[model samples]
Target: MPIIVTPRHNSPEFKEKCVRLVLEEGRTVAEVAKEMQVGRNTLHGWVHQAKVMSEAVNRAVEAAVAEALRAEREESDARAAADRAEIVRLQAELATAREELAKLKGKG
Candidate 1:
């Protein structure tokens, strides 16, 4: 006669904590799985899932940062354009004032 063993079901929170212990706490999957009395392969799968989720979050953050940088650059460009226009207007006004001064001096 052959003997068989039944598998045990663990809670989702328990699985997440075990995965965190291996991925975030710097513990080996085998070590944590042993401590938790689970199979090494099972813990590895959870760790893999966690890594995939983390990668997705990282990509989203990078995209958001890139968008913010682009928006800031656009705002800076608009400000620079406005400054240039103001400079041109001031130069024109200064030239008109100089011309008026020259006329007054000629009359005197």
Candidate 2:
């Protein structure tokens, strides 16, 4: 007689599908578990784990956005400072040109 064996661990894709069926289809864990031949508690645990992972992913995304914004702001500030320096340099050059013109006029 051949012995029967069931796998102990479910694949991540299967776990995701089971979680989605319960979450997206508005089905009860027990109902989905019964249909899928999984233990009710195991399905419930999968759902809980999915929710936790979703929250963690959301937090990570928010943090990344904030970091990107901070870096953009710093870059903008640096550009603005460079612009101000260029403007000051141009103003000083104009002043020197004006001073030279005044001296030439006085000498002429």
Candidate 3:
């Protein structure tokens, strides 16, 4: 005859803490599960869920950083355009002033 085992229910908080002990506290899943009196497979599943959640958060952060970089590049391009226009205007004014000075010297 085969031995039958009953399934145990654990709260969300309990599962989270157990997963944290394995991930953050450097404890093994088998060790934690053994200490917590839970099944090793169940603890492993919690750890897997935690890893998936962490990867999702990392992706979100990377996307946000990429967006910020893009916006910064756009602002920089706008500033460069404005600076180039100013430089062109200043050069034209300088050329006109030089021409006037040359004409006045010639008249003298």
Candidate 4:
């Protein structure tokens, strides 16, 4: 009989599912490895790697959220400053109008 070999190229999604099966489903590494036709050590590595990657992703997401909040706060501050400046301009315009009206009434 001719020898046939199975390719060892497992996709990341497949590795994630296998890791989930072992971790989330509470299945033994050996059992999942046997069922999935993967080596026991390989599956264990996948599970450990998944945990490490999860922590890294969580940290990255937290940093991204913090940066976004900071940007939003800065934008809000800028808008508030602009609003205050506009209010001051409007108040000055109102005062000038009042002075002009007083002068006109005195002349009348």
The TM-score, computed over Cα atoms with residue i paired to residue i, of candidate 3 is 0.79
Candidate 1 structure, TM-score to reference: 0.81
TM-scores of the candidates are 0.81, 0.84, 0.79, 0.77
Off by over 4 Å in 3: 1-9
| Winner on lDDT (1 vs 2) | 2
lDDT of every predicted structure (CA atoms): 0.86, 0.88, 0.88, 0.87
lDDT of 3 by residue, 46-76 (tens): 8998999999999999999999999999999
Q: Write the per-residue lDDT of candidate 4 for residues 1-108, one digit (tens) a residue.
A: 322224542777778778989889999998998777788888899899988999999999999999999999999999999999999999999999999999999999
Instruction: For residues 2-91, write the lDDT of model 1, one tens digit per residue.
Output: 222233426778888888899789999978977787778878988898899999999999999999999999999999999999999999
Candidate scoring better on TM-score of 1 and 4 = 1
Off by over 4 Å in 2: 1-5
Cα error of candidate 3 at position 56, Å: 0.9
* Clash pairs, model 3 backbone: none
What tens digits encode model 2's per-residue C-alpha lDDT throughout 1-108?
322224633677778888999999999998898777788888899999989999999999999999999999999999999999999999999999999999999999
Q: State in Å the error of residue 53, model 2.
A: 1.0
In candidate 1, position 49 carries an lDDT of 88
